[model samples]
Target: MGLPGEMRVVEISGPGGPEVLVPAVRKVPQPAAGEILIRVRAAGVNRPDLLQRAGSYAPPPGASDLPGLEAAGEVAAVGAGVSRWKVGDEVCALLPGGGYAEYVVTPADHALPVPEPLGMIEAAGLCETFFTVWSNVFERGRLTAGESLLIHGGSSGIGTTAIQIARARGVRVFVTAGTEAKCHACLELGAEMAINHREADFVAAVKDATGGRGVDVILDMVGGDYLPRDVRALAPDGRLVMIAHQKGAEVSMNFSLVMVKRLTITGSTLRPQSVEAKARIAEGLFREVWPLLDTGRIAPVIAESYPLEQAAEAHARLESGQVAGKIILEVA
Candidate 1:
């Protein structure tokens, strides 16, 4: 069957709030060389999407203006030089941008087969957080088996993923959440300790849990005031990978503390990364993590889902701070 001439999409109608995500129609994107077009079934809502909508983050040059970083769907077309996927293959891909539509195009290597255990909605939430965590927590942070790790935003999609993967790999996991319920959720997800940040300082709790040695690695998204405290919570030779600074990026911190602790502070935002870099992350996930997912040892935690047209509502829900996991928009 021939493809449609146009498809439904939600565009960022100028920078503002959720209401700026308005419904529209656009021509179905054609797959370029080594690229594949996906007929999107569902898309994940992420903090980066919110930032893009707010005008703080802009789509990379030559990328779509739409605001989606991950999506799951079936192959609708395959571009020249693409061999790994064909039309109708179900895939969930780490997209550079332009996922907020009925169809989207991305490099073939950036797409992975939707694990046998996950459906479209579940798979939609996989790429962004999984890629982020795997790269930041394991590759950049150099977290290893038998080490201790601390994750901020323990109830978030990235936090839940890091908990399971770390536990499965024999790393002790600790997490911080704003509420008791969120803490409980993290604990259930294999965190050895979930500290309710509202009740106790995470640094002190992690130090106490680790017998005052501090953790080996810290994955933080909240910058601002938490910066110096993150330093205090690290063991000697610890690594801190900052993937997001939701509170604000500019902050005062003690570099001397970082130097004395022999800490490595590094971070990467996925969107601006090269396609080859993301492909490497995808390869790592397939080699090391897919089996756990296939066996149900780890799964995507979906907090809520809304129909495609209700993207505004979905964004509002995610920004509401009540969601403990990923929010999805079902497009199929």
Candidate 2:
């Protein structure tokens, strides 16, 4: 795998909207030890990319500064100490950043084989959302069989992943989406009940769905005001794993609710986590979830794909908050 001279990338010139993503050509990257170079076929567009564009979320220390976090393609080359994968292996990876380009370098351990059942586009869309949900909701939150899991934004990438993974594990799911249509989409994907947050109070609806017992775990992306209602909606010993603070991070909430229910609150970002920590999660996912993908029990729901040159449009679509599932960019 001889390295190419240069690769085309969609880059953010400065802090601003989607229009700020400008196309540029840069020297192809060389993989460091334990890293692999991928000929990027496609990249996933996520909310964090939008935030990075606005200068709200910067790349974690030592991670790539470019925007895309998930991508799928073939391993064109491998660096020293990379024994598990070789050149020409079809792989998809959860990149820390630098995916909105023709080629991106990633730690070989973060790369997973794309199942033959899933095409490159769908594989491109899996890494970020599935890794996030598997780590936060199941691994950390401890969602169990016969237990109930509540997910916010049920039609978004993470929401959709949580729904399928929980369902496959025999856990009942309740999700909140913005519209009846989105709610119905969640139901079709296996949620026990889909609440239209705009038309009904999710707290009451969740209670009703569980016979007033409340859900066992909640995977929340909305912070601030949702914190209180999330507490009210928990079952005894339940967990609320907050992943993002889209509504805002600060909140005034009662501690008694947390104490009375014996609730646990925790969250983590993949980029900032130590490599050893992520490697642990990757192992768990490999043992429990990878087989599902191998057998087709779980797969990514790709809502749309845009060309690399149209990267700005992909960001704009994500900002609209109307995408049914993961939106991806084709690097070619």
Candidate 3:
């Protein structure tokens, strides 16, 4: 199929709230060498998109100002030297930006073939959270079989994926969510225990669930006070991987506990990383996670979806803190 001369996209009209996301038409983007132009069928709404809309996070240099970070679609065009994909191949990809458009260009290596059982809509929500969880929870946190993990925000996309993937690998999974319903959802996704943070103290709950040994790994998004609590929740030689600071960045924690526990604390932001680094992550995901997806051992959990023109509403829903899984924007 031939490409269009222009495509519709959701642009950040100004830095503010979800209402700032407005629909606009732009000239179709051409992929440079090593990139491919995708005809976007759907896009995933992420917390970073909200941060970008609020002017707290900015796209990296040379990336699109559009907010979406993941998309699923068919290849429409390929740039020179891009041999991995051609017209009509269906794929889902982790994008630097610009997924809110009807068409997007990304490094060919960032795109992966959609799992056999998933359609474009569900596949659309896979890239961002899956990549983050795989890179942080498994690679950085070093969670392995026979170990245990504590996941904050357990009903969100990242939490759900981590829960299933870790469980599939024989790792015990514990999670904390904002509501009882969300907690139950996490448990249904193979978590060994799910604590409702609004009603229970997660640190206490995790300690009790682990018989006071504490967990071996923690995937934390809420920083601030959580930093100290997370420290208290880890066992000796444990790892705490911080991905976001929804609470706040600054914190006061006991250095003595960190030293005594021999814990490791680390984090990373995916969009700003080099193409080679992301390609390495993509390779790992394809080799390890994709087979699990194909076998139905792991999957994307879609909470809701909206039309491309209603991108603002999708963002609003994501910001509402009521969604239990991923939110998608249907473009095609």
Candidate 4:
């Protein structure tokens, strides 16, 4: 099949709000060596996309200015030295940028076969959150079986994924959400406990829950005021992995507590990582996590989906703080 010379896309018209995500068209991207061009069937909406739209984030060097970070589709073309996939293979991939289009190009190593019995919509939601969770929670945080983890945003895409993967591997999971309904959703997804942060202090709750031992690790997205509280919520040698700061980033943190508790504080943004590093994460997902997805042990909790053209609406839904899981943009 011949690839189109141009394709449809939703580009950031300006840096402000969800209304800036306007439908447009762009030339279809072509794959380079070790890359594959995908006819994108669906794209996942994430917080990073929101940041990019708000002019707070920018695509890494040599990446498209488009906002999306992950997508699922069929392989339309393969570049030189790309033999792992062929034309017509279905895959979900972690993109550097440019997923909000009908076509996108990403390294072949970043793409994985669509897991059994799941279509493009679910597959589209897989790579970004799974990669973030695996690299942050397991590799960086060193969370292991029998350990206890406290996730700050339990109802989010990353939170839900972390809960399932940690639980499936024998780790106990706890999460904090803003609402009771969100708490229930997290509980249903294998979280051992769900704390409504709006009603109670998470630090107190964690200390009480663990008999004052605190948690083995904390996956925190809320920074600022939560830093001091998180220090109080961790056990000796506990790890805290921050993936974002919905709250402000600047904080007056006391290193004394960190030293006394022997704690580790770290965080990462997935978009700017090297392709080689991302490929390693992809390998881990294929070996350790794909089976769970294939067997239906854990699935993408799709809160809602919108047509490709309704990207503004999708972004609005995500920002509304009412969504429990992923928001997908259907392209095909």
- Candidate number with greatest lDDT: 4
lDDT tens digits, residue span 1-332, model 2: 36789999999999999899999999898899989999999999988899899999999888777899989999988999999998899999989799999999988988899976998899999889988998999888988899999999899999999999999999999999998789888999999999988889999999998899899999999888998999999999999999999999999998998999999999887777877777777778888998888999888888899999999988988898888899989886
Measured on C-alpha atoms, candidate 3 has an lDDT of 0.93
**TM per candidate:** 0.98, 0.98, 0.99, 0.99
Residue by residue across 26-57, what tens digits does model 1's lDDT show?
Answer: 99999999999999999999999998999999
Candidate 3 minimal-lDDT segment of 10 residues: 1-10
> Whole-model lDDT, candidate 4?
0.94
Candidate 4 collision pairs: none
- What TM-score does candidate 3 get on C-alpha atoms? 0.99
Which pairs clash (backbone N, Cα, C closer than 3 Å) in model 3?
none
Clashing residue pairs, backbone N/CA/C < 3 A, model 2: none
Worst 10 residues of 4 by lDDT: 1-10
Off by over 4 Å in 3: none
Better of 3 and 4 by lDDT: 4
Cα error, residue 79 of model 4, in Å, equals: 0.6
Q: State each model's CA lDDT, in order.
A: 0.93, 0.91, 0.93, 0.94
Q: Cα RMSD to native, each candidate? A: 0.8, 0.9, 0.7, 0.8
lDDT of 2: 0.91
